[model samples]
Target chain A: MSVLFFELAMTAYLVVAVLFMVYLAGRSETLTRACQVGTVVGFLFHSLALGQQWIAGGGFPVTNQFEAASFFSWTLVLVFLVIDVRYKSHVLGAFVVPLAFLSVLSAAFLRGNVQTIDPGLRGLGLTLHTSLILLGATAFCLSFAAGIMYLIQMRLLKSKHFNALYHHLPPLNACDWLIGRGVLVGFPLTTLGILSGAVGAKFVWGSYWDFSPKQNLSALIWAYYLVMLVGRYTLGIRAKRAAYMAVLGFVAVALSFVGLDALMGETRHF
Target chain B: MNLIVVGLSHKTAPVEVRERLAFKATQLGEVCRQVTDQSAADEVMILSTCNRVEVYAVAPNVDDGFATVSAFLSRCADGMDVKALGPHLYHYPGNDAIGHMFRVASSLDSMVLGEPQILGQFKDAFEAALNAKSTGMVLNKIAKKAISVAKRVRTETKIAENAVSISYAAVELARKVFADLHHQRVMLLGAGEMAELALRHLISAGVREVVLSTRTTENAHKLAEALCAEGGPPVRVVPFADYAAILPEVDIVLCSTGAPDYVIGPKQVSAALRARGHRPMFLIDISVPRNIDPATAHVGDAYVYDIDDLQSVVEANLEERQAEARKAMVIIDEEVDTTARWIRSLEVVPTITALKGHAEAIARGEVERVLNRLPNLGEKERKLIEGLGPAIINKLLHNPLSSLRKEAQERGGRDMVETTRKLFALPDEGAAGDAPAGGDDE
Candidate 1:
């Protein structure tokens, strides 16, 4: 039942992504509302799917690549819902929802890779640690999407030619505010999650810092964000430059979160 | 139903003729009632705007319908020459009238193509007719469909997406550049007519602060007073010599001076850009000889759109709207066909009723005759026989009835209605028009 719900949500998200893309090109209000409905329905089923897994197995599901991918994509949907509802910019979904679709589809590809739930992943601390990290990933994706929007809008503003998207997309100041809000919340959550993960690791493996591939990658992601925040705070890096840095930082974080897991085969990484 | 439209619009009549024929809005309800009482049209509506004066009606007879509306218009414009107005009058009957309604509602017939004001005017006319009890089922249905068709044309086409006028184009460009214009400040260069016009648009858009400068301060004050009553944006007058000094604090610059030489230069724009932190600024130079240096646009975030540029934008927008208007016409054609089908389908209802009535009467008589000849028929079976007779008759008639309805939905469905009435041997009273009327006959 959980898998069925997951697949249904994945299909809905796929349709939503396509709908949003078409809506951007067509600038149809009907299609825009349909996209919002699709996103909400997909989110509802995704929540049910994740809830069913925890109810059936008695714990949070992040034991394998499939679970990890699905869980992260669900978090991304939650973030999109918040942004879409709060900002009321249908144009933002056109840029951000494709990433959600890709992540969920990639989870579908990793279907056979579902390993048994590791005992180390069952504790409350481990669940909290991973959930916080997923939330942070959600914030980073939003920031990254806003950054891309900012750059495109800037380029269009510089050139004096515009499409419908240019008219509908939020102004550069709004994009910067979104990124700033993302960093403000995401930085602290990521920091605490990493620290909590270290504590959970010590409790399970008798070590606080292992310098494993995952740890190293996570540290690199954290350091890059730290430098960006510091630059924003101290050096007064605002608007376009800050937007570019956000895109770059999010790329590194995505690589660390998704790519590092496959490279480190024997090293247990979440 | 015979729907007729007798009207004169900007396409056919001059403004002088239109003004002479238009109805007063305050007396619209009374005039609408008069038309309903005077004409053979069962339902009546009068649409009178600045560009057109039209009367739409659903009439029992098209000839009387046109005569009544024409006489009403002619009588209303008592002092005008009927001979001069005769050439400008346009009368359409039946489906052609419906198509005209669709076109007018969709802004195809508007002087400024795809303008939204006509639909609102139509709604007002519809409401006036409704208040006068002059619109019945046919006109009511058509009015609703006309509104929906207009809405579809707006959303489904790009007809109203871009601005078509120079001042409106400037305002639209400002909207594209700034997320919120309510907080922005505007500086007006010289009090040319175009400058005042652009200022009106800006002020209406919620521009809070406006610095108006001209060689004549009194003219600036007059323009400012015309724009604001009280407790609005303070339109302060600036000396023409110091207008350039205040450029750094303003977000938009509207230059429409008569000066042949450039009033704003690249150096000044560069200084303003630095003070404004390189923020986006719109410079609309609507002057004929051009008041701003073209090189001023070279500065980062300083957008210079001259009069010719704005006119070119308007032309491009007009071209786009023309293309979308073609698409809208296609939509309107489909709607017109749908509406025509709906009108034709109304004919089938009475025919089907008469057919069912005739068949049921025959079935009842045959069942009574059978019951009367039976010797020892049980009471329950006799009752069952009586009920089964009408059931069988209805079942047998269902196929032909539904087929007639389906034919009524198709092209040339009017012929199908006529043929059905003749073949079924049903009474032909109200089988064609079917508009509601009080009579001794059902």
Candidate 2:
């Protein structure tokens, strides 16, 4: 029953995301308000459903592919909501909601048949590891959105396009500041997640660096983020280059989340 | 309703008259209040800027609201030569007035075509009027429509697509020359206004170093201090005569001195380029008397964008944004129609009330007749019949009543309502409520 509600809530969220995109494209303020209300309601239902599942499963809903993917989408929306509240920018929804929908859609289709939770895998370290990775992924997602905005703004400024979309976009200084802040917050969590994963591996498999495909890809993603941060400080990369690096970092993170699991023939975490 | 706009702009009125008529930023609220209190118009809004002073009002039963607003404005100017200023004061009634406002909000009417500042000014004016409670339904509709149009113009038109201002365009040109400005050094050759604006833009663009040189040490020091305080690197105020000496160090030089003759002559420029080893320099000549000699282009690796060249760039940018301005106007037109319709719907109230009144009156008269016929019957029976009669009348009228109530919420439905009332000859308020109807409310 709880799963049913969760699925229903997710469906609503997907619809609301589409509506929000339509609202932004049409530039309909009335529709934008409706989209906000719809998204908020969807978030509430999603939260309620997740709560029910947590109680039913006797753990946080971050166990397997279905739960983790769903949780990732949920966290992204939560972050988006926070940004929207702080910035009061309905424009963010145009970039954010689509990704949220895609995340949920992937969960629905790719992890439909994954086993719920394996009782043996339910430990504090594993939960913490999963949580850190998810949080880092969420931050990366936000940075990617901000990066896309930065790139668009750069292109517009280059081409001398100061149209409505350009005006709606926060200034270059503001975007850089936001992306930097996102990275600043996310970098430590990502570093901690990788370190803790190493520790978890040692406990589970009696080795810290076993060169698993996932671990290797995770390190590569970390290195990409490191380049972004270093370039920003040392080279003083401001707008376009910084944005591209952040975007590249997100892509690397996404690949690590999915690519290695596929290579290992491990559909358990889909 | 006739839409009217009567205003004085910098183009039409002298500084003395415009200043007199101008609603200073401080006095905006007070002016709005005075206009609303005195005007026979159903709505009023005053838009005053350094460049334009406008009074928009909707007159009751007047052919043109423009004359009324014009008279009001003339009175404000205290018997100045209104005719001389009147020619400059363009008047647009009805649709023209609406279109004029749309253009203004979209920045089509601004001194600088496609500049974004007027939109903010318009918003400020509307907010001020709202705060003063001077705006009525007409002004409210116009203000909102103006905003919608401005937004649409920004989105759909090519207007505002480019950097039209010399300062912003200079920054763009700088970017093209140098991929990044983070480490670039900028030099100012004079303490002119144009130079200051351009320098400010460059500093905001993250230019690291700024060196100031002007005829006066006081002016140069002042500019340097201001720039340094704004987070840019500490500025160096070089002596005007030492520009030839300091010219070798900077990557970009912005020149706008007021000298009668060419300040940076061919000999001076060539020698400086030689000393600098021709490592590519960007010079922007914004002075009318032309600070940099025209022959200086012969110097290798130096790219110059003069004032006229910058003006052409601005013109091209303006053309692009002009297309957007039209698109925005179309959107505003649609909003205006929508708002007008909504306002028209206010007419439905009278129609609905009249319809309800007629039904109540008939119901009451019939109940009275029934009571008279049943005078010999018991009081309980009489009360029941009376109660039953109202219920039947209410049920019968429910659909029409609900529809009229709904219509009242729609735009332009009010006229339809008044027509219905006049056709049905509904009685006045006192007669309508005198029906022998039973108690319906708790």
TM-score of B chain for each model?
0.88, 0.73
Candidate 1 lDDT score at position B9? 97
**By DockQ, who's the top model here?**
1
CA displacement after TM-score superposition, residue B7 of candidate 2 (Å): 8.2
lDDT of 1 by residue, B1-442 (tens): 6789999999998888888888888788898888888878888888999999889999878998888778777878867655666788999998899989989988989989899899999999899888989888888888889999999999889887888888898888787666668878999988778777887888888887999899888888887787667445878889888987899889899998889899999999988866665565789999989889999877766778889878877887888789889999999999988888877676566677777778888989999899889958998989998998888987898898878777877764667767877887777755434534321111
lDDT of 1 by residue, A131-182 (tens): 8887887788888988998888877655655566666678776787777777
- Highest-TM-score candidate: 1
Which residue segments of model 1 deviate by more than 4 Å?
A: A1-19, A29-70, A101-133, A194-236, A255-270, B16-44, B63-84, B126-162, B211-215, B234-249, B259-279, B288-304, B307-442
Residue-wise lDDT of candidate 2 within A149-214, one digit each (tens)? 777866655444445565456655456666787787788888888788778777866888876567
lDDT of candidates 1 onward, in order: 0.82, 0.72
Candidate 2's C-alpha runs over 4 A off are A1-35, A116-118, A163-165, A223-241, A267-270, B1-193, B199-219, B222-442
Best by lDDT: 1
The ten-residue window of minimal lDDT in model 2 chain B covers B433-442
